[model samples]
Target chain A: MKLSDFFRKKSSGSVAKDRLKLVLVSDRTNCSPDIMEQIKNDIIAVISKYLEIDTDELDIKITQTEVDGTTEAVPALFANIPIKNLKVH
Target chain B: MGEVIVVTSGKGGVGKTTTTANVGTGLAKLNKKVVLIDTDIGLRNLDVVMGLENRIVYNLVDVVEGNCRIKQALIKDKRYPNLYLLPSAQTKDKSSVTPEQMKKLADDLRDEFDYILMDCPAGIEQGFRNAIAGADSALVVTTPEVSAVRDADRIIGLLEANEMRRTHLIVNRLRADMVKRGDMMSSDDVVEILAVDLIGVVPDDENVVISTNQGEPLVGNDTLAGQAYMNICRRILGESVPLLDLNGKKGLFERLAEIFRKN
Candidate 1:
């Protein structure tokens, strides 16, 4: 209830939940963190041919997302690629 | 024919043996003919947990290897009339018994007992395979820790792959007070992460340790964990028993609301 605590770090439970979500999704997909890094590199290699992407800010990982018209959740590949400019080919 | 269920957790020290002992005892208290098989092989402890270690003259290996009949190897429990335990071989390793022998053993017991529960060993190895080979269903035990939940997910996947689809998750050793204080994961949180149907949740209680040390199942005692195991037995029998309110404060509020509505 303290106002100062509002700016404190996240609770351990939430931190554990987040970590488990990431680990479980990866385990389900058989995609290790090394594989995820390779995937990020592959995406950057392909996308850089068309646009100048900010590789430093790009984020990608496997996570669970609900599908349309279904209550069940499934593993999904999420990517956030920031494009700097279009390459004039 | 009776149903054969396996209690397993991929990680060690997650209360799989304790769950098997209590649930088997609970079913027997309900007057069902129940037999618990310890398939941990070399590292057998169900006998000690059930206080039948001294009575285990012949074990699963003897029965399978034709050394003795199954009737001779089954040690009757000290308390329940219908409860029995088929202890594992402490001297032999996991490779001594094959999955085929286990399947035949389970099939033979199905005609006599109402329920057959197998206490599976930790890890996805030969012991795990042998334990689950004859199982009609599975009870995957896990704690609220990150490592336990992650291993539970792996075990669920393996069970499904083996065509043992009737699997339910038991969240054991949950600290409700810690959960309320945002320091531990709740049962719901674990269920959501594992994506398995929840059969029951056993709160973290010191009574469980005391019972285990005393070589008792804790199903006959008056404790929250004991009540939760009994509820799980009812659920297993196709009865829809509500989950035990481990956090007693919430239960008190519900009782107060009921009293006001009755007035």
Candidate 2:
């Protein structure tokens, strides 16, 4: 088989894997895509209570990656919270 | 020891009853005394699938209500001598039966049979609770579809909450052609999300429909789906069998080759 054919096959496999991951993550967590989006917004709001953070810089995502032939969904909430400058008295 | 297994699915039409019928038949074929119980009260289908609907003179409610003995309610399968069925009551609702009753019924059959398979009703309601009440282990059935998998996840959570630790998964109604064409979910994809040990994988076979309609299980000889059920039966018996990929093109090619050889 040509290299392009090999890459095409791999890409097809990747697409199926990606779809499975997306569906499975939603199923496993019992959180629909809409719910996940709402959760992200909620997290952003909660973080804003203690720290001034950029909402645009927030990276809240549910992702599934394969490691050692096992697929795992890692739900991570990423944010850049600014530290307040305090003067020592 | 009679192992009480509850075959459950959170979503409907994922083949829970079909799995129970075939697997029960499969085990019976191996000379294991099996008792298949239909817990889907008010919507019972196991009797029809097992071809024992006509033989149901007394049902689970009759036994539970003390109107009849358990032995009188248990219908023996004509095809398999060792296999018996405890058909559900069509007129009664799920509330008519309690978890304690189910557990006691299973306990009564424990010493008589090697396997007690419960055909659980769909949803996480009273029916689901009554089905899983006496189960020593649970077999969660799901199709290779998004909705089915989601329901399976929820069922697993419920099973865990009930403290039923021995849980296995069965992914049914998989279409190999669609999986190959990237139109369906593969077995690996399902297992990854469910995070449970898979017991079996059954392909979408027209024979399943034919047998079900005929009120006969597909666990007879000459059916691909039958062979799959046989494998699942062996696995349930604690045999170390490799998981067969029903969606694998290579396996399909081999099955076709077998047909050609026979011809």
Candidate 3:
């Protein structure tokens, strides 16, 4: 019950739980770490053909999202890429 | 009208057979006509667990292939009233039956029994598909480990994909002492990851291992695991039975360790 331990972000149980959460999301969506990395590289290559994007700051993740008013949360793929410059068409 | 429930866990050796044997026997103990079907095929063992292995004459594969009638395949429990065991064939593999046949068999079983419990094979393969094809509901069993929990999560997802009516969870072989030491996943921790309705929590007990080894039916007893299965049966019957107070502090060794740590 130490105060320092209370604020510690990486308690053993929580650490395992967090890792499992990340893993289950990928499992349920049929996406793995390797697959996601490949996907990120592909998406970056396709998007960079037209625009100079900040690939370093780009983020791609699968998150739980509620659609409309449903009770059950479904996994939604989210990809946010910051654009540095856009080539004029 | 009866309920066909598939007792399944994605990973192997997470007490699926034990849960099926105990819950079916528990329901029969409550005076409900229950038939337990072992769908594991070649690796069948629910009959062994329920002590009905020696009595199985014609099994599931025989019944499905029309070599024998369904009634002939069902071995009545000599001890438990109104409980029956429809054993699987040891000679046949999982593909000996198909999901369509299982669905038909489940429909036929619903006409005569009050409850039909299917002991599903482990893994999400053809055996697993055949097992779940019949049941309207599911009970995902898991141990308190990361791998077991993850497998259970996938099972829940599969159940949802199949549009099963309901999916409940049973956390098995939980070591309360490890959870208290913050070294293992507790029941609450399991529920959080799986995101399913909680049916029961079976504390790790030597009684289970001993009974399993002896091929004896685990009826009501003072053991925590027995009580947990009883509670699960009650819940299945729509009764609001509370879970065991598995606080993890009552065991003598746990108490001694806590005292030493405090000193």
- List each model's interface RMSD: 0.5, 3.8, 1.4
What is the alpha-carbon lDDT of model 2 when measured against the actual structure?
0.85
Per-model CA lDDT versus the true structure? 0.93, 0.85, 0.89
Expressed as tens digits, the lDDT of each residue in B152-196 for candidate 1 is: 999999999999969999999998889988899889899888888
Q: Of the pair 2 and 3, which is ahead by lDDT?
A: 3
| Candidate 2 segments whose C-alpha is farther than 4 A from its true place | A1-73, A78-89, B245-263
Best by lDDT: 1
Clashing pairs in 3: none
Worst 10 residues of 1 chain B by lDDT: B245-254
What DockQ do the predictions score, one after another? 0.76, 0.25, 0.49
Q: Please identify model 1 stretches exceeding 4 Å from their true place.
A: A1-9, A52-58, A66-73, A82-86, B249-263
**TM-score of every model?**
0.90, 0.81, 0.84
**Candidate 3 segments exceeding 4 Å error:** A1-11, A32-35, A46-89, B248-263
Can you rank all candidates by lDDT, best first? 1, 3, 2
TM-score of chain B of each: 0.94, 0.93, 0.94
Is 2 or 3 the stronger prediction by DockQ?
3
